[model samples]
Target: MKEIPKKNGFTTPPGYFEGLSERVLNKLEEKDTSALPSKEGFKIPEGYFDGLEEKIQDKTLQRETKVFTLKPFRPFLYAAAAIAVLVVLIIGLEKNNTSTPTFDDLAQAEITQYIESRDLELSSYELAEVLPVSELEIGDFMESSVDQDEILDYLEDSIDDLDELNIETHEEYQ
Candidate 1:
């Protein structure tokens, strides 16, 4: 076949195609328009490729969001961790409280020693004056009181008897 001169983009031979025999031209036209085997071997499902592309784009967006969203909660996480550590230390130390003496317990022990001592001179001035009171008078009134055992009991019993006997009767009611 003679080569064709290109006009615009077609590379057909100029008068050669025009002078082509009818049967050859017809056969050439038929072959040109005939469909080749479909490219179905490499084909994917219709919307699968588009969905995959969308999924990729969504994953990229999610990654970007995660990268940018981390800063604000970092301080809170650190504070919570610090608080947890402090709580653990406090709980560990609190477990040993029974071994440690509280101020109130020490005071109570000291007061008891002062109260039970033989020598009144060794007692505090406050306890020394009240030491002469008898044990029987100390029990009924100050049974539950820790600090003042003797004088408080005597005074409390006296006050209760006085309160019971001093009741006033209204003349109108009588």
Candidate 2:
């Protein structure tokens, strides 16, 4: 084939066309040669290649993939640890507590001593039958009764018969 000179923007050298045909025959190949100047040799007019085009490209709305990573459940772990520690501390405190004497213990001794010391006065009548421990309740029962003298008299007369009566020793006689 006769070689033809290239013209206009779609032009290539006759040898370059021949090379392209050869490349087609061999396999598909890209045409790297352009009718325009190479990028390295390209020079723009003053202020021609400003950042405006880049700014426009950036402003163009487009979908972007965003990845979000959630933080670990460390706070919950700390809270659970605190709760467990609190529970353990509460249990330890409970276990370490010693048995303390209640009001019942204190009142029991006082009541027993009072009764034994004045058994002769108290046993005369069936005072225990009328006023039992279950009826007396847990507090000061004698503090509210209106017949204190009658109660004392009954106790004295009842216990006077007993040989253990030490009423004379309790008197302040000279």
Candidate 3:
């Protein structure tokens, strides 16, 4: 039981395949055609050929009495189940979504939910990789409403806070 044997036990003598064709051909050549069975050991039932028409008529002429049974509406049941799954999926996809949240009404909880739900297409890190919002050139806003003097005055007022924050300033490269 411990040591399993690898041998198959069945083996052929040496030169088995070498003369196989010649041996088979010799046996076939030695066969006596006259000694072969004439009826091939088969027999037809008595009166089988004589009553062929009657037997065929008995099967063909009679009504089959089919009850028009369905296999318990199995295919239709599967189709209905599939349609129900599709309907549920469609309804769920439709109802799960909501309208965009308005900025004025937007709270910290809504922002957190939006982030957690992955509703925002890009994260803040991805947005930073694109043009930073500060570097954007908005010609419409710059030409009309923006006042350089007012901006300078605001910056002068909060110069102390800017220094306190230790923010790095960009050096002009010319």
TM-score per candidate = 0.19, 0.22, 0.23
In model 2, what lDDT does residue 71 have? 91
Sort the candidates on lDDT, descending order: 3, 2, 1
Specify the highest-TM-score model's number: 3
Global lDDT for candidate 3? 0.72
lDDT of 3 by residue, 10-115 (tens): 9999989998999988987899767866666877889789979988998889686878876574688889999999999999988876665577587646765777
Ordered by TM-score, highest first, the candidates read 3, 2, 1
Q: Once all C-alphas are superposed, what RMSD does model 1 give against the true structure?
A: 25.4
List model 2 lDDT by residue over 124-154, tens digit each: 3566674455745534545565564565566
lDDT, model 2, position 122:
55
Which ranges of candidate 3 are over 4 A from the true structure? Answer: 1-4, 46-174
lDDT of 1 by residue, 8-87 (tens): 67466677766469868787677955475655568667878767987887777745334455556468888999999999
Worst 10 residues of 2 by lDDT: 165-174
Top lDDT hit: 3
